[model samples]
Target chain A: QTVSPKPSRLGLCAACHGETGVAVMPGAPNLAGQRLDYLRAALKHYRDGSRDVPVMRAAIGPLSDAELDAVARWYSVQIPAAAKL
Target chain B: QTVSPKPSRLGLCAACHGETGVAVMPGAPNLAGQRLDYLRAALKHYRDGSRDVPVMRAAIGPLSDAELDAVARWYSVQIPAAAKL
Candidate 1:
């Protein structure tokens, strides 16, 4: 029996949501093309803490359900970034 | 003569992204709290047609230098999502 392939679940989240999430740190808010049901309901509201933070409830509270659906399907595929006036 | 204030730069942006910059639309990346520098550069790219998007060009093209600065600054104030894993 062998199993352990999904360890890199956006761990550090690209060091402040970049490399795909779109953010390059700073205030950090680019979740790269977010969609997939609103990034799985905001990662299930930070793993059910109701979105208050505390490192997003300790990084989504141990994540397991398929690694939080494979890191919200890899930032919901990434593409947005537009519509700013 | 009367002066109009900013005319709501966020505009349709809120239609897709949330009231702030987070995405509520499918495939739309949330911009809640991106860095000022990064957001500015990306917007410049779109305005110049280097990133490839008709809609972005249309939206960002007419913006003057000051407008650009304002929009970027707005998104630069949001907090970031935690490290996902």
Candidate 2:
């Protein structure tokens, strides 16, 4: 679990959400230190189109459940962006 | 800004998301210390039905813009559940 996420995983999300869980793109929410179950559920919903954000749906569409879980966990364990303030 | 939320505001969210932002309901996500902007966006979405969770939509249905912001801000400043763990 300590292993870094695969480049493919971070590569796609980092375009908007940043490499270390902070969101780099405007209006993108920081994923760092989010709740694991919550992130997991969100990812699943995005992938399945239940949540229906086109960018998020497309971004996670190709991923398997394991990949989603891994990415979600990675973001969940990172230090939150707000913790610095 | 430091004034506590009106009892009506907390009363609805507190049924599942606890008074201090932790979730008392099993499936409810912890809201404490979540990003302020993110929470604001989520509250708006829940109110408007774009995010489409029936329970959340109904719970926030009666709130005004100011009330939603007040509640979101209250949750955003509280300590995170994970931080306590």
Candidate 3:
């Protein structure tokens, strides 16, 4: 699995989720700095239909496991925005 | 905070995500059997605008931290459907 990818290599996920994994769309979740295992599991679920969101499933459809892992790793490593209460 | 709630008490999250946290909606995610820390952190981020998904922000808007914790607990304990590859 590719453990380190440059920000430019984030690819498909960046269309909805921003380059850094914060979402640009209203319904998409921010994935920046999320836990690696959660991102990995979620990506797998999206591919396999366990998560069952049409857009997500479609987005993840053609990706191989290594690609998914690289995408998850890219997002997990980005710095998440701070929470403001 | 209520650590143990019957499925009925999953409440708001269940409206889009099903009673067991498996999403029935096209855009919603399956929260069932997600990690507790991830769920808890996500709930807080939603409330704080860190996650910034409009539907989730609105859904979590009126809830307190303790209430969020309860919701996280509810979903985290649910049985996730197996990933079908």
Best by lDDT: 2
Model 3 chain B: ten consecutive residues of lowest lDDT:
B76-85
lDDT of 2 at B80: 62
Q: Which numbered prediction scores highest in DockQ against the true structure?
A: 2
True contacts kept of each: 0.24, 0.16, 0.00
Looking at model 2, give its docking quality level: acceptable
Q: How accurate is candidate 2 locally (lDDT)?
A: 0.73
Q: Give the DockQ of candidate 1.
A: 0.11
Considering only chain B, report the TM-score of each candidate against the true chain B.
0.73, 0.84, 0.82
lDDT of 2 by residue, A1-85 (tens): 3555554577788788777666777667767666677888788778777777899988887877777787877777766534434
Total backbone collisions, model 2: 0
Per-residue lDDT tens digits of candidate 1, residues A1-85? 1222433767666667765666565655566545567668766766766544567668767778677777667765644342111
Instruction: Write candidate 3's Cα lDDT for A25-52 as tens digits.
Output: 7656656555577678677766776555
* Model 2 lDDT tens row, B9-69: 7889989988876677866777766668878888777777778899999888888887788
iRMSD computed for candidate 3? 13.2
| lDDT, residue A64, candidate 2 | 73
Off by over 4 Å in 1: A1-6, A9-85, B1-7, B79-85
Regions of model 2 farther than 4 Å from truth: A1-8, B1-8, B81-85
Colliding residue pairs in candidate 2: none
In model 2, the Cα lDDT at residue A13 comes to 84
